[model samples]
Target: MFSGNGHGKLVGSTQVDELGVLESPVVLTATLSVFRAADALLSWLMERRPDGVSFNPLVGETNDGHLSDIRRRPITEDHVLAAVAQASDGPPAEGCVGAGAGTTALGFKAGIGTSSRTVRTAGRTGTVGALVQSNFGGVLTVLGVPMPADELVPAADRTEPPGNSCMIVVATDLPVDARQLGRLARRAVFAMARVGASFSSTSGDYAIAFTTSDQPPIPDGEIDPVFAAVLDAVEEALLNSLFTAVTTTGVGGRTSHAVPHRAVIERLTAAGRLPAPPLIPESPSETRLRTTPARDEPGS
Candidate 1:
């Protein structure tokens, strides 16, 4: 939730799994600082719960080589605490901020993006969610359609390298375990592909998913379903990141045009990829509830 060198923490977001059954909140950050962020986050938690419990922070990241001050290494405890203190439940920001501040996607400016879907289960409602640090190769196809690379930040050539990376995080209130969550993470790749990303050996296209549905001491009788929720949610969230972002200009006079809204509307409309409202903006605060399950995501 925190941003700007003045107001936000520059450190990576962190999460700690409680014996593979529970996970702390997710954290996003730059590619090289995952360990530092995780260590700091672990320290904060240990001070809060000094029970000798083991908790490994789930840190995700993308390369921020173009726009960020990579050498400064600006993230700090204050930034982490501030972001945590100000966390809210609602739409995530996109374009250039957080871990995405220095990333690219489909050959254009890219950053954080999120989307959600509703699923129906047992006569209730549930939300499958996704959040991504946008950084992927450019000049590719999405759903078989050729997408010209963002000319704004033209690369020297195509087939140069797919150095971009993405930290995809999927979450749900449904019950599921790490194994299932891992599957959901992999499924997120499909969504990324929808956005015109190919799995190059060099690109770190990783996804991490989790569900709050399962509680401690889960009984052997039954286990909650989470794959559908995580997969769908992550897809939506990744789309949200692209949909919400705006273009940015930074160091080296480098210009990275965000997913052009006009182009988005035009292409999606033509392809029937448009969703209602086109996008949603979150408030400083968000609603708190535990909706069950539903399907057909809002947009992504």
Candidate 2:
């Protein structure tokens, strides 16, 4: 596996950078619980690879102090193991859960959001999936249209926490090496920019992308499709995080509110940006010559 860490206090980042490989499960948690989370991950990995003494437990984080009692360091070994044990391919829980439980994005109650895209290249189809912990600040945009933040979110309701951060994890089924994966990760940052993130000096936007396929890496020239897919998926995923979140009140009674869905849809529709609805198929007519039985002509 391959991985990356950006501006946050991301543990094990240097190792991943030096070796270009991920040797353990990536655990995401609040800044205060990075050590406990890492210990738990290391303990879990040791059970599987008993001889591995130098394995780097990859754990990442974004500051959630404003909305979470981070000083309490609530994440424990049990919580970490429970997450690893229950991992599955079913639909993921998004918006205000796990590491995203106390996150905000673009001045909204943002959390976990995920999206995927299928790309075809050289007669092969691959899927690129993005899961983002949306805990950063910026002007909110949906599908390239900017939202008037001041009008939509008054100063009183805005609860953008300090030390803004976003963690983007990308998974693909295409065969790509560390170098190519790094390129893909950079494109994810571009996706963030499209959604109106400024990549502020401290926002700490990071992306980690890995491929599941074992085929030889596709040449650099053929990677455009994958890059485009990553961009589209990351943008949609960020928007989804905001759309699915509910207004939440957390530490110090600070509150973050979810974006209004109906209003966004209306705006998009008014802007002529919504795609056409799918058309339903009509049944064939019984009188169609191909399906109708001819008179008993030649048989008689």
Candidate 3:
């Protein structure tokens, strides 16, 4: 786990830092509901554990008070358990879901975003995946190009305070130990700056990386590709969070608007950063002819 700023509560981080292992599924929730969520996670884990054993429930959080009734502590044991039970493999739903439902970032409605990249090193192929709950403040930048001032949200609409927090979770299929994972986590946190994270004093910026591979840890010399993958995947994930979120009306009628996609595309295209759209097939027959696979002759 790498923490760029420690302004928010993150339960079980000290243990993960010391022992370099996460023994439970991570539970993410609002700031005030963190303890309750942790307790629920612990209860759910205990039901299946052997007697006389200790466990640590890994729960992380970001404040969502601006958009939700956070002080009410809406998260409950059932909510945590349902999340654990419904977890499955494959692409996860992103943007305005789960822990990110009430979050915002870079003056736009932000939420859960995820992305993955493939890496090859030491004659072995691996994958790196990142999922981020983006809720921070900064000027939005894309592909090193800043969005135009006129494209930004009007000043009157920017009601949310300057800083909140972002929680990044990185997973990999590579053979790496906790030490290496920590390095990967650091790269994830660093990638935040690529998309214009302020890293403010009041913001909690953290990344927790873990590997699922059972093989022995790879040598540090072969870790460079994995590090590069982390940067690319995380940067894209942050952008995805903003791109996929929809405008949301929150507590006291406060609103966070979604980033303007069409205008952004136009800006990037004008800046020569985005390519023009490819020409479409003229008709269905032409499209079929182009897409159809070739068949083998009778005897070849």
Candidate 4:
């Protein structure tokens, strides 16, 4: 319904701000491929809206040159059309897929990561979801525990530190305006710092926050919970990016290593920061209810 930007290469952002609405689909891709995606989307939209003269196609990007031949400019309109056609409603594939295929973060292979949180405001519950293209540098920290740089799997020796930019997208079902969504976007970026993002001068760190419902706008006084949810979700999303990403060899035979999950778990557990393990989910047959309680049954 509405959206906001933090900092990054965002095509069609001006229209979203000027109109207070997103009138087209949002596509995320490699920095150099953004325009191609937008052109493809615009053509697709044009066919759908025969009477429409103009439209703004929202496209966001982060550089993937460290791991991909970005100069080749390989993305095509057909690729964009195929993605649009293949869209489905289900859990998305994360960690080195789509736009995240060639990204590296915090000296490790990083890619698409997602997380969500449920929050209540005015007795109404809504979910805030975050997806991040994490390709930025910083000392990796998880749950307030420091993960020393030496402990990580080593990357191939490089002239520069591994990091370029990060693109975060936050989606919520809460009723909020463009201005409020902007605030939410800011929080998502702030969470980057928690995970050790330097927000370096050369790095492009940006967030886009949007709502997906028609409910009444939440009052400004009642927005704190929403902010907290955004912060938590974004932080978790970035961590997930690191945890799930595996070692990858990319352009020019350059390799980026994956984070050591066992090491992190061990550290967190030793620090008394890990939560208790969750209960095993019940099977469908086990979920059936008996007519009588066990203590009241004739067999008992």
Better of 3 and 4 by TM-score: 3
Clashes (candidate 3):
0
Error of 2 at 182 (Å): 0.5
| Clash numbers, per candidate | 30, 0, 0, 0
| Pairs in steric clash, model 2 | none
Point to the candidate with the largest TM-score: 3
Look at candidate 3 and tell me the lDDT of residue 72.
68
lDDT of 3 by residue, 23-124 (tens): 899888889889999999899878978683788899998887778777667677888898899999979888777888888898888889999999999778
Off by over 4 Å in 3: 148-150, 278-300
Score every model by TM-score.
0.72, 0.87, 0.90, 0.86
Candidate 3 clashes between residue pairs 3 or more apart in a chain or in different chains = none
Candidates arranged by lDDT, highest first: 3, 4, 2, 1
Query: How much does each candidate deviate from the true structure in C-alpha RMSD?
Result: 11.0, 15.6, 11.5, 12.9
Q: Which of 1 and 4 is ahead in lDDT? A: 4
lDDT of 1 by residue, 72-124 (tens): 55666666656666788866665556667666676666668777777555444
Off by over 4 Å in 2: 1-6, 275-300
Q: lDDT by residue for model 4 over 53-139, one digit each (tens)?
A: 998898888887777777666778888888888877677778777888778888767789999999999778999999998888777
